[model samples]
Target: MIVYEVFRQERKGQAFAHAGSVGAPDAAFAEAYAREQYGRRGESVALWVVPREAVAEIHEFVDELQKNYHRVDGYPLKEKLKEARERAGTAPPADR
Candidate 1:
């Protein structure tokens, strides 16, 4: 089996994110291949090469139910704001 790891630099000072993976024969091949695949048209600033065996893959997520509490959009703010405005009696125009 052949495997290749790719690390991409999103922007200055930003750590590279493991965008995805591909299969290749060796390190040199992976580097030559990845530079083109990831940086083609200069989309990325940098990349790292690693063998398939050297990389660990995480494929499983432990979420067994809804986990909205960890999300910002989880809490409905518009309705709460409207209720607060009504209670405070300081609501402004719809356009404002």
Candidate 2:
């Protein structure tokens, strides 16, 4: 395989994300190198290493077409907040 996958966790109960990639001959060497390359400073709480051939990769995620309706910006609140503040007679404290 042309690439090796490496993942690292920030701390206990945290998620693991892609840290980097390296080249190696076997799983033993790849795991050793990946640990050193990504967790040398004792920064990672855990790791996962896999060969490129054994791992599946996809770059064409559909984040572009899929709207994030659960995101903070997805909730329209500017007009509602302005009206609420006006109703409460608390007009957004003067800008500094």
Candidate 3:
């Protein structure tokens, strides 16, 4: 028997979430079992059944060096805004 991972969409336009698993001898059986187990009551609008062995497992993600430049806070917009305000004569440059 093959273990199939099931994902179900609760309604139209909704995202599919992991429903559960099913053990079946083939793809056709897996689909039937997954549909019955996850969508029998019409609670799920769609279903996807993938063999568990086909799924890739990722346990960890590592960043060798910390990088802040990609984040919005990495840009010092406040300093630039202050400079622009002074140039526009909207406000006096701070005495700092």
Superposition TM-score, candidate 3 onto the true structure: 0.71
lDDT of each: 0.80, 0.84, 0.89
Off by over 4 Å in 2: 59-96
lDDT of 1 by residue, 48-79 (tens): 77776787679997767769788887899999
Candidate number achieving the greatest lDDT relative to the actual structure: 3
Local accuracy of candidate 3 as per-residue lDDT tens digits, 35-63: 88998899998998999999899998665
Assess the local accuracy of residue 79 in candidate 2 as a C-alpha lDDT between 0 and 100: 88
lDDT of 2: 0.84
lDDT digits (tens) for residues 1-96 of candidate 2: 457888899899999998989898878888888888998899998998877678877887676855768578777889899989999998867675
- Work out candidate 3's RMSD over C-alphas: 3.8
Error of 2 at 24 (Å): 0.3
Ten residues in sequence with the least summed lDDT for candidate 2: 61-70
Pairs of residues clashing in candidate 1: none
* Candidate with the larger TM-score of 1 and 2: 2
